[model samples]
Target: MTLGLIGRNAGRLLVPLIFIFGFYIVVHGHITPGGGFQGGAVIATGVALLLVSYYYRDCLERFIPITNFKLVESAGLMLYICTALAGIVVGSGLLFNWLNASGGLFGHPVAYGVNPGDLFTAGTIPILNFAIGIEVFGALSVVTLIMFAGLQEKTQQEEDAEAAESAAPLVSKRKKGKGGRK
Candidate 1:
């Protein structure tokens, strides 16, 4: 069940924008302050919006297919691990910047003095950020889906009824024996 028409419409409009912002944060993580974890959180928030805006079944049919989330998470983890290992194998040590100042991918030689932001100079950092973003997004989205999906949200009346039932005094069902002494 959707929150309402306004919520549904807003979610429809904003989900895509949220995804774009998340991707932006992930891609520019090396240069900007936002990084993989932050980006992944943002993306998960987008998924959350969809969940609250629509039913889980609707979301699965219209927005996302949950089966692939684990694969995405695994792929992200493997990419991160492989990248780190590649540093040890190809470069000097673990997590070493394999393309630093080498005139290749992200290898532009940074000037000695104050330098403007260079997108291609950060190299492996960007790759790591991407991997982390993918992993986090998948994991968090799956968690959110599992927690909320297919569960009936209790209405206010239902909650009140439940509370009243629990609060009511207990009464004996069995008949009293020997002048209610037993």
Candidate 2:
């Protein structure tokens, strides 16, 4: 069974809201509490809501294509690796904040003492968060799609067995009496 009309409508409305909120968390994560992992989980939860509200076939066709998710996953992972590798190529340590205090682009100088937070001041953190968020979201969505699709597909043999079982009549037989007569 699937969601009723209200549930389906709610899911449709809420999914976008969930996505925006998730992105917000990811972008602001360098200064705030929520980061890539948390935001990714939130987005995945929205996808799960979609899965529950609709049939698997429709979800896969109308929205959650596995290949698209896989592509996104790969892209995120590649971006993360490239960004990390950039530090070493620039003669800095791995995962270094090479852009900090350089005064261009993501190289904004961060105040040493207490001050208001600047989004770009965190440098590679935001980029890392973006990459991780994308990877997590894609991986999770793909996993959900695969699981639901597998459950929904019906094999010919399985269908036949179900049909035969349902078509068969119910019969009861009593054991013979002690004397071999009833």
Q: Which residue pairs overlap in candidate 2's backbone?
A: none
Lowest lDDT 10-residue stretch of candidate 2: 173-182
Which residue pairs come into collision in candidate 1? 106-120
Model 2 ranges off by over 4 Å? 153-182
TM-score of each: 0.77, 0.78
- Report the C-alpha lDDT of model 2 over 64-173, residue by residue, as the tens digit: 57898899999999999998999998747787878767786667878887878888777788899999999999989988878877776644355545655554443222
- Write one digit per residue (lDDT tens) for candidate 1, span 1-182: 45878998999999999999999999999777999999999999998998888766644644567768878889999999999999999999999988788789888877665666788877798899999999999999888887775586665455545655564444243422112221
Highest-TM-score candidate = 2
Each model's backbone clash number: 1, 0
lDDT of 2 at 65: 76
